[model samples]
Target chain A: MKLMIYAAALFAGMSLSIEGAIYGELGKSIGKLESSFYNFFVGTIILAVVLLFFGKGSLSHTFKAPKWQLTGGLLGIFYLTILIVSIPLVGVGLSMISVIVGQMIMSIVIEHKGWLGSSPSKIQKEKAAAVVLMAASLFLIF
Target chain B: MSILILAAAVIGGVLLSAQSSINGAFSKQAGTYESTFLTFASGALVLFVGILFFGQGDISAILDAPKWQLSAVWFGVGYLFLTVLAVPKIGVIATNISTVIGQLSMGILIDHYGWFGGLQIPFDWQRGVAIVLMLAALRLIYIADRKSALQKKQAA
Candidate 1:
């Protein structure tokens, strides 16, 4: 069961890589901001249609939800914009590694704190080692 | 890289983790597609205003793009949808690391194959070692999480 969840996450990551490449081309053809706009714009339409047929929850609950939780969209935009800006300044390799390290560190903190409604998982030596190894691997790959 | 640039890049990753966590929690309440739709809808609304003010590229260029290229949005959709489903179950660290491993693995394959007109960089020993190391890391994390989870269950 855990392995299945891991595989799903892995597949999600693979999809992201492909999307990144495609959007990279789109960004080159259009402006970066424009391409992003296009993505969200088109995505909104697509999801709207899907929700019409398949959605099962109340979107209105979204408004009643905590204000901070609604920042997903803003965070998404910030992430892409930051990468677009920082990758040019720092080399892609460094940027990529830094991002991975940051992700691991932040994730550890989030899990440990039970933030964002995630169950608390105390940090262990093995988990720390795993993060270190993963960071090292990214450094090598990029 | 300067410290500032490194910080910015890292913050980008931080935002990514936060986005996943938030979206995952939101999906539990609003349903996955509904949560995703709200995100894109809100994001599009903001970007529309951004484009109105600062967009420089010809937005019409998207219309001329190959049909396959447009399908990238679906890949993006799949990524977020899966992430929303995974994070609450696996926790943020596991989901994020797994995704990172997958992303890099796929990226290496794409580079090696020179897919999408990219430069053909042959697979080297370094990349192979890196992948092996990543797999090891994943295994270690899994065992660690499993051990802790089991302990918690026993304590309960």
Candidate 2:
């Protein structure tokens, strides 16, 4: 199970990287809204199919998501918009550096407090420092 | 403007953190498909409102988007699946660090090689050294994870 989790993390990283590359290409031709529209549309189609075929639940399960959970979608829109907007203005390297810094700081708070109903874990100093080091590396690379 | 950008980045980070936490909880409770679907669906609705209220572009442009551009939707699918599967297991920081590293590495490669539609950058010693440092940083973080795992094992 632990191995599966780690594998999932690696896969997630690769998937996101590929997505960023694809988005970079798309940003050239389409406005951010249209790009995001197509993205969400395709994602919805794929997830709908998966739910219909593989998921075992009634229609209610689809709509039964909690109110707070909807914030995830709002955040997605914000993140995507800012990312697209920032990249053009700041360059990919700088925009990404900003994003990494943001992600690291927020992730520590989120994980430590278990905000949003996640399992709680305390923030360890070493791990925090490691994240900071990673962020510093972004400055070097970008 | 730089200060504003920095502030926005910080706020964006907090939002992302909250989103990640919510996503983790939803994934655990609702499973991948439903949670992913709901998130996208809700997000689409929000996007729709933005388009309706703030958009300046012609709606027809959506249809006129180039074939390659339209295909970018696949990236969204990949992102959804990844977030659902990864966040709960690895925790937010590790998952995000891995993602940032992967993105930066790929971005550099694309820029350096002019892969796909990427802009070419002259590869030089400084850039090479930077890549090395990024890899080293990633290694350090991954090692930290090993220590974490060892600690957990001892606790168990």
Candidate 3:
């Protein structure tokens, strides 16, 4: 558990710091659609090579999956474009604050409903406290 | 503008969390980087198809773009690996809170100096206090994690 927490700290700290700002700036110069397209374009080429050489996984199941299961890519389309545009208008910190809050609320809902075929976990008091702190931080962040 | 931006940010957040869990599940079947690769590959295909069907943007604009501006893809790769891996270990709350703290600090730095050509939004006292509180919450969450861990240890 301790080791996991430490690892999470290291990786989570690295995320949301630079990417949105960079993507936002790219969107500014090249347009959001084009910028996002290039991001995925480059990402695809690199991943394709890795998938071919390093991946032992098969895409057969992926093709057989339901349409909803495959919509992760569609979600990425919205997320990439939204962050790109939001950063320019609201600044990086505020934009991410919004993302955090959005995720928080929806997570609470997902937890309560167990919407995605997972076992339902009830929200504990400590989690509620954390949520309040996050909510308070949002006003200051904006 | 504020409303629109806030809505967009919220939507991005929801997607971010959802993808973390989804990709975490994917990591069970594939190598860590392999999972990341598959995600990007799928996303790329979607974007390409979107372009074919409805992207009204100029293709030349992307090709004509400067080289250095397209560096965020690597960051995407990094974030995805970390997110997919982290969620399984630390759960979503810890994963996201840590991510937000790092992102805010870096974001403030970038915004302070206007890095990456973004319009500068100078960091101020209100933002500072908010950040401090959020950091404190990290400690709070970690402590909770430890306590629960200890309880499990005792029960075991």
- Considering every candidate listed, which one attains the maximal lDDT? 1
TM-score of predicted chain A against the true chain A, for each candidate: 0.76, 0.74, 0.85
The candidates, ranked best first by TM-score, are 3, 1, 2
What lDDT does candidate 3 reach at residue A109? 64
Which residue runs does candidate 3 get wrong by more than 4 Å?
Answer: A1-15, B30-34, B53-56, B81-97, B143-156
Weakest lDDT window of 10 consecutive positions for candidate 1 chain A: A86-95
Q: What are the RMSD figures for all models against the true structure?
A: 3.7, 4.0, 3.5
Q: Model 2 reproduces what portion of true contacts?
A: 0.49
Screening candidate 3 with a backbone cut-off below 3 angstroms (N, C-alpha, C), the clashing residue pairs are none
lDDT for residue A109 in candidate 2, whole number 0-100: 75
- Best candidate according to TM-score: 3
- Scanning candidate 1 chain B in windows of ten residues, the lowest lDDT window is B111-120
* Candidate 2 or 1, higher lDDT: 1
Candidate 3 residues A39-64, lDDT tens each? 87888888777677877765655655
Candidate closer to the true structure by DockQ (higher is better), 1 or 2: 1
Count of steric clashes across candidates, in order: 0, 0, 0
- DockQ (C-alpha) of model 3? 0.52
Quote the chain B TM-score of every prediction.
Answer: 0.76, 0.72, 0.77
